[model samples]
Target chain A: MSAPLSLPERLPAISLDDVSRTYTSGGSSVAALEQIDLRIARGETVAITGPSGSGKTTLLNLVAGLDRATSGTITVLGMRVDGTSERELAEFRAHHVGLVFQDPHLLSGLTALENLVAARLPFGHWRDLQAEARRLLAELGLGERLDAPPSRLSGGERQRVGLARALMGQPELLLADEPTGNLDAATTEELIGVLERVRREHDLTIVVCTHDPAVAAFAERVVRLVGGRVDGQQRLDRPGPLEVRSLEER
Target chain B: MALSGALAALLLSGPSHGYELHATLEAELGSTWVTRPAQVYLTLGRMHRDGLVTSERVRQETRPDRQRLTLTDAGRQAAEAWLAGGPADELVVRLAVARLVVPDRVPSLLGTMIEERTAALHRLRGARADDTGGFRAEARDAEIRAVEGQLHWLEGLRGHLGELVARPRVRPADERAAELA
Candidate 1:
């Protein structure tokens, strides 16, 4: 087996302590999340699943530093995300967090290569970034589509490119919001395979917010959000041995 | 036979090398089907000899040449035939034979079997709970239902066995002989 991607031994990738997010509209306040506490270890794959309006996206945003919690603390990669300044959060996001939306959000006019290279521009010059982007895209099975624009690529291919773009920053944590929502069954399976492979190869801590059970099943653990609160959490059993030898022995 | 037939069907979709074939089978069948590299090679050999598959060696730069396997017309026909046939009821066959030979022990045996099978199914269900793949989910659901049906049948058999035991039938010759001895 390949050696697991080494990470800082004890520091968690994410921690949420009594985190809550509330939105107010028309003089009525709605809790998008309530007193949520969660910890995700480094290099772990977790899926946040629930019905619509269940706070899955809200929780993901808090972790990604895109949205601040109304109450409680959120720490990701040892950074205080809950109350961090926008500038600090932006810097943290640039270096440590990669986000993928339901739509790939790739530029319509940019080629696949350009989209990835462009994402790296904020970090530095794009000259050396091209080779890394190309390699990442190739690893995602997009080598042949390097010059193809988002309009020309299939949904699965676009998602793969999105995934490639996420890796450009070499982010430790990858947060995807409904990554496979638009894909067909075959494409969904393909995307799952790609995600699993990429996670293993790069040792990424992935948290995908989705309602699809299939997508949730790919994760090592699943946390169910219900009505803006954590309803339950389940650790999915990895595929085990073919036969339970004890049964036969008996 | 299941493994060979599955391999043939996989080849019908597209030609693949040995390693790729093993990976594909694992993905398709999940952890239920345990296929070793040797088993894949052995099955390929048999199929090749039987004119069901053909192989061509493709040279690699840094490694030894690999053989890519493709299905023959006969292989395609055989795979279709295999798919057309209903699955064998192995559990039924085993239970029937066990009941004939050890009627007294059938209830206990089946009880153990049911308990084990149920536990296994629960584990499988938990493992596959989040799987979104259509083929994997459908296959898992079918297997779960089959196990449940068996459990239901076993319960009924246990009830009937209880009634028979309660009827107080005459002791068999062996039992009588043992008592006299």
Candidate 2:
């Protein structure tokens, strides 16, 4: 594993410098994103909300180092995601970044416990991985589901499994892509609570790509994307629905 | 309802093993359908007893023996009926009424609803690209388009809700006001 890069003096957890992505659609190249500049600080949960074709997913892919930008640089965890080689990006993401796609994406073959253990092994560390995995499963109300296969799990349970998998590696940066898109309201809140717990416990830098303000209400900051650019932004100092407990209550 | 339909569909596709049917459903439903394999097989066993399908053990040279399945005539009839039915107009209910009913969230929810409709439209359009003579491509497209228009109207109403629910804000008395004087 690469040495943890020293963060810049007072630098944010993530910074995007004039990033843009273009794609060929209908025989014409369309700018999926404009020159987007944004910053997210450590332990901050930032939500990117946008309409379809506004490039919310594209922006997320760039930040998560899953895709490269057509232009400009993206600094995440003090490394340039835009210019990193594929191998480096994969390694970096495996160790420093965790992703929750819209779908749970759990391997059908693995049990809930095995799914998380698999995520840990790739980081070249399995010592006590099982214990960590079990703890996470317990947190998600899946203590009984440790041995259950994907087929036996409910829609919500499968999502919980996915969340546990993402956090198993204990990555500082967490990116979620519509993690609650398919969930019912009750399940969505449950999932959000799980996410909030993980974020606080790990002091994670979290970014969520969602169109739902209900989802965005969990974030400390909300950035609206219009035409692939930051249309508006607001810092949510007051507690939103996601914050259910005060420090004293906890 | 979707699961039962899927079960019938898979059985009709071929005499498939219970595990294969579960995998097929997972692939089709993406994230919405969640269930364990053992439970699915147990359900299949129940269906077998109920005369929906038949199951048998097949010898495997590799590791463990395999279970195979075949749909009965009744299963085929069920699948046909399911395929003939149109989409069910059911609202997805959740516990986040505070978020959904809250007036401030109206605009963003409306936007997301529109995005979902657009994605559904793309799916419909793409379905037509393959000349599957079995489906009514034109009718499906029209139906999806109608839903897309309705989502647009919902978006308009949500914007209005945002306006109606916003509280009156009193700006702080500014030093600039005294400077202007």
* TM-score for each candidate, following the candidate numbering: 0.58, 0.55
Judge candidate 2 at residue A135 and give its lDDT.
Answer: 91
Q: Count the backbone clashes (under 3 Å) in each candidate.
A: 2, 11
How would you encode candidate 1's per-residue C-alpha lDDT over B1-181 as one tens digit per residue? 6556656765766787777667644543456547697998898899999999999999999778999888999998876544433122334423433333334655656545544454444455554556577698777666655655665565456546666444443333444665898
Error of 1 at B39 (Å): 40
- What is the DockQ for all candidates, taken in turn? 0.02, 0.01
Error at A170, model 1, angstroms: 0.7
Task: Give the Å shift of residue B97 in candidate 2.
Answer: 25
Please give, for residues A168-233, the per-residue lDDT of candidate 2 as tens digits.
767888899999899876676567667767765785889999876556656767788988999877
Kept native contacts, fraction for each prediction? 0.00, 0.00
CA-based DockQ, model 2: 0.01
> Candidate 2: what's its TM-score on chain B?
0.46
Q: What is the fnat value (0 to 1) for candidate 2?
A: 0.00
